[model samples]
Target chain A: MRVGLDVGGTKTDAVIIDDDVHILARTRLATGWGVDAVGATIARAVDLVCGEAGIAREDIRSVGVGMPGQVAPGSTRVAHAVNLGVRELDVTRTLEPILGIPVRVENDVKAAALGAHALHGSGSGTMAYLNLGTGVAAGIVVEGQVWRGAGGSAGEVGHISIDPAGPPCRCGQRGCIEALAGGGAVAERWGRPGALPVRDVFDAADAGDALAVALRDDLARGVASAIRVLVLTADVDTVVIGGGLSALGDRLTTPVAAELEAGAEASAFIRSLRLRERATLLPAGSPAAALGAALVGRTTEEVLAHG
Target chain B: MRVGLDVGGTKTDAVIIDDDVHILARTRLATGWGVDAVGATIARAVDLVCGEAGIAREDIRSVGVGMPGQVAPGSTRVAHAVNLGVRELDVTRTLEPILGIPVRVENDVKAAALGAHALHGSGSGTMAYLNLGTGVAAGIVVEGQVWRGAGGSAGEVGHISIDPAGPPCRCGQRGCIEALAGGGAVAERWGRPGALPVRDVFDAADAGDALAVALRDDLARGVASAIRVLVLTADVDTVVIGGGLSALGDRLTTPVAAELEAGAEASAFIRSLRLRERATLLPAGSPAAALGAALVGRTTEEVLAHG
Candidate 1:
């Protein structure tokens, strides 16, 4: 049996999977501040899942962890994760001694991409998974492996400057896709007198609110522009959109696909080649990061054994 | 000994190197229309170099050719090169058969990056090479390997949208770095009645022409914005500026450095990290693309053999 744990800003989820890849048990818990509290929460979740699965602690071969941060090789020490309020936390040391199993750590978005890939094996080709939630980020899978650039900073689709002089991004750049189209940006643009939540903004747009409609279209354009850049740079066949805002469904996918079609026709080189447009929308499951993390551990072990 | 050949828009260049990597001989010829003419020209250049080095053709271990287009793996088939007005040209089949030597073909910009890596070797850690010439493109090298994203379409940095609503780009996009900051853009902007060549714009800027100064600063801003995006995506230690336009030394580098520094300060996360600021403003020698192409063959062979 293997365990997957996804740690997010609000919650931590754990899933126990048997050898046949069936989900045996699952548990969720609120995440707390500080490394020790987070570690305790994860350990408790793991224990709960293992008990529910009717498995002893030793039966759990390995644990995989996913979080928002830069991870070092073969270690759980996060190099940097600004939103998570943690830096250089020795996750492996904190969790491994308590859990009594080998652990692996990876970037949360990367884990999600892996999960998405596992669900649709066709994504083994050059695939990009974009997350448009509180922030916009991407995890690129190239040839069935994550293409982490130097220092694990690849697939930062959010930071690609779409507007040189537009709104400032959290990354300190001007007019990044994130600054203009992320969930926060959508809320800021549509949250009028009542300060509507991001999800409600989409609902209002569906109800024909002019401001919300415009905001939705603008977000779609941003997503489309990002897709165009990805195509031009990676020449990937599939693009999977996940994260909080993607729940809007057709409100996001239709316009984004139309934009891509328009942009492709604009370039002769792009026009010469036929591109396979994979699913524009996909649900990365609520505990996708944790599942992806567990899969990472499983795959890493497989690769190491075979390699 | 290795040979480097650059097949450019107007001309083809070839350089021969000895075991010690010293340049032995160089040849230049017009790049004719058909593949046969181009192949013959390359063969003649190789013969001339071998004669100059007083070595038999068999002694030349490998040949590298750089073309202005997309290259397939293990072959010199030009997938698409708009500048050369050629598509799907079988360069390796044509040239290797004629020259009776092994040939490797790569994108010109990638070759230039390899050349820059070989010559300067300053940014040996994690480096990027941005070529601001007739067109603006970039080649990213991470840990001494060219990062060919999913397919061979990884380093089309020029196409990243800078302005979604700005001027139309050659790639059919609007407000790409190429549309605003490439050599053609500069020429079009300043090539008014009685206006000098694009090279003279730099001279005029040096002479304190206000219009020229503004143009130079704008170019720097554009390049700086691209650099900022690169930093966020790649987290490289250094960036090397090459191509015909990089001759504008500090006029371009200083402002770009300043802009990036200002951008770094906009976010606490960006500021907290130790961002490397090593920038090289140097032009590769004439025929750098060809030399870089040759180096590609040598490097790839070494990598394959070792792996």
Candidate 2:
């Protein structure tokens, strides 16, 4: 059995999977501050899964973790995680010896992409996966391998500048797609005077609120623009949209699909090709990051064997 | 020995290299319309190089050509080239027989990235090569391999939407980066009344014309925005600027570097990372696309050997 864990800003989600890719058990708990507490929370979730499944700890062969931040290969240290307020935390060292199993960690978006890719059965094709949650980002998979650029930062679709003078981005650029259309931006635009969660903004949009509708459309445009960028740049045939915002459903996908079609026709090279869109509206029931992390471990093994 | 050829909108350039990587011979000629004429022009250039270097056609080894459109592997059949006014032209079938050698073709921008990666030695790391010429596009190189997404369309930076409602792009989007910053757009903006080329605008900017200065600044901002996108999305350590517009020199690079520095510190993920700015100026000696094409042939050899 393989154990998968997803550590988000607010919650730690865990799942256990068998060789056939069936979920054996799952658990969730609030994510605590500090690296040690977070590690303990994850451990509790794992233990709960094992207990619920009536299996001993030894039955779990490998543990995979997905978190929001930079992950170095063959190490558990999270190079940096901005939202979680953690940096350089040795997750493998802290969790492995305690859990008595080999552990692996990966960036959450990359894990999500793997999960989405696996779900769609398009593992052989190049896939671009975008998650529009607190922040917008992408994990690009080309022929089953994640295209991490020089510093493991290749799939940063959020930072692609959409406007040279539109709005100031958190990254200090003017008019990045993330700055204009991410969940935080949407909430800030449509939420009440007090800072409301992004969910409420979607609720308002669904309820036919004008401001909310406009905000949603704006967000859709951002999504479409991102898809265009992906299509034109990566020439990936399939695009998977996931994250909290995807719950808006057709409001996001319909417009994004249209935009992608339009962008493809604009480029001579793209015009001859057709692009396909896939929906990842819900987080995979399994801890995708964890599974992907496990896959990473397996890939490392293969590489080592070949070398 | 390797040969690189770049076929631009106005000109065709060829460079022949010795095994020691020294330029053995070079030639340039105007590009002609129709597949046959273009093939003949290329053949003439290859023959000139072989004759000058006292080499047989067989000793020439491999040939690489960069054109302005999509290309298939192991063949020179350009799938689509809007600027070149050709579709599915079997360039390899037409040229290889004439030259009696192996030939490889790639998208001009991808070839430029390959060339920049090899010539400047900056591409040894994660590198993003942006070409600002008749059209703007990017080529991403990671770990010495070009990252071509699903359909070989991975670096169309020009089509990344900047405005959903700003201006109509040829791709049917409103306010794509290409619509705003491509050389055609610059020429259109500066052409007013006389319809001068973009080069005239750059010359005017150098001569301290007010309108030219404004246009130059706008162009700089556009370039800066692309750089921001490159840094944020790719986390590339080096950016190689090429294409005809780069001929503007410091009038472009100085402002772009400043803007990138200002923007990098704004992101938590980017803040801790050091972004290095390499030479904005490429070697004026060789056309980047042609050099890149030669490297593409070399890459094809590597891929064939490994396969």
lDDT of each: 0.70, 0.69
TM-score of 1: 0.87
Model 2 per-residue lDDT tens digits across residues B113-151: 877776664533677788888778888776555766565
lDDT for predicted candidate 2 compared with the true structure: 0.69
lDDT of 1 by residue, A148-239 (tens): 65555566777766776667776776677887779887777665654336667777878999887777776776787666566555555577
DockQ, each predicted model: 0.42, 0.48
For candidate 2 chain A, which ten residues in a row score worst on lDDT?
Answer: A298-307
Q: How much is the lDDT of residue B303 in candidate 1?
A: 37
True contacts kept of 1: 0.54
Worst 10 residues of 1 chain A by lDDT: A270-279
**Winner by lDDT:** 1
Model 2 agreement with the true structure over A137-256: per-residue lDDT tens digits: 887775566656656666677877676555666666656788767887766666475444555655677898888766666676677666666666665667778876776666566656
Give the chain B TM-score for each candidate. Answer: 0.83, 0.85
**Which residue pairs clash in candidate 2?**
A162-B162, A233-B153, A233-B154, A233-B155, A234-B154, A266-B171
